[model samples]
Target: MPSPVGHALGGAIAAVLIAPRGTPTGSGSRLMALRARLSHPLVRLGALAGCLPDADFLWGRHNMETHSVGAALAAALVAGLALRSRRAALVTGLAWLTHVAFDWLGSDDTPPLGVMALWPFDDRFVFAHAYLFEAISRRYWLPNFVTHNAWAVTSEVLMLAPILAVLVWWRQRGAGPRV
Candidate 1:
């Protein structure tokens, strides 16, 4: 899977794109006109969601069931219930799913490759095999591992920078007009 840096960056990028900055002129629905008042906090919260799936590592295994798309949706639903906002569900669920997507596209050199992304239903491990992201090596948390992760972080930043920029531009462009 890609580093948390990549996943959090992806979540930040998604937050900028999905968050409603302001109510557009003459918008009808209340939800459509919403300013997303707590958008700033939600932004950080959404980014945090990207890292939550890895919490599964504390229990038994990594990526077996926690990385599932169904799990992501369940998380979103729980987030909505907890926060009392559908928008919360939307942003968080998608952000969490982005982690799984990154893991899918990332390089995995260890045995029993890929994650059970479709768990509880299909129970099949899947991967993109395109290696758009470098796998994060946490097997060793030593100084050498820091250097190794540094390289991975550099690569991730280089690749994800443009997407983040585009999402920022998109958010700024849509901040005023919804048309």
Candidate 2:
């Protein structure tokens, strides 16, 4: 299966393309970034919560809907309700869908063959291969999220460093909070 980077990279690309194009505003950037960051932890927790189907805690074999489209959409909608930012929700949804798309393309399995990302909406799924093969056996594929498992819990703290630094700098420069 593809790594989180692969998933997020796909998300980022789709976000760039599908994100609303309007006056470049800090609010938009903040919303997009937060949506992306927030989705990560949410997806992780959702997996742990057993709310996400087809997901195995150790194996990482799960449907894309849990970690991608459905989860993302749910998160975005909640964020939108709380923050009233439609753009944020849009970015989150797009990012999620992008993850699903990438998974479809990169995963060796698709729909009936593998994960069904567009379940309920569609039956088709993109199919590909694992990004990292077993270290001992290159023919076999490795699991995704291995890189982030240890650090997944600290994501918010990790994100805070840069977000705070930027915010403080912006504040010191007399630029008020945009959103």
Steric overlap count per candidate: 0, 7
TM-score of each: 0.82, 0.43
lDDT of 1 by residue, 45-135 (tens): 7788887888888997787788888888998999899999877788788888888888888899875677789878877889889888877
Task: Extract clashing residue pairs from model 2.
Answer: 104-126, 104-127, 106-128, 106-129, 107-128, 108-128, 110-114
Off by over 4 Å in 2: 18-61, 64-69, 109-112, 121-179
Per residue, candidate 2 scores C-alpha lDDT tens digits across 72-121 of 66866875676576655665566566555544444243334445665547
Query: What's model 1's lDDT at 128?
Result: 86
Strongest candidate by lDDT: 1
lDDT of 1: 0.76
**Candidate 1: residue 94 Cα off by (Å):** 0.5
- Indicate the TM-score of model 1: 0.82
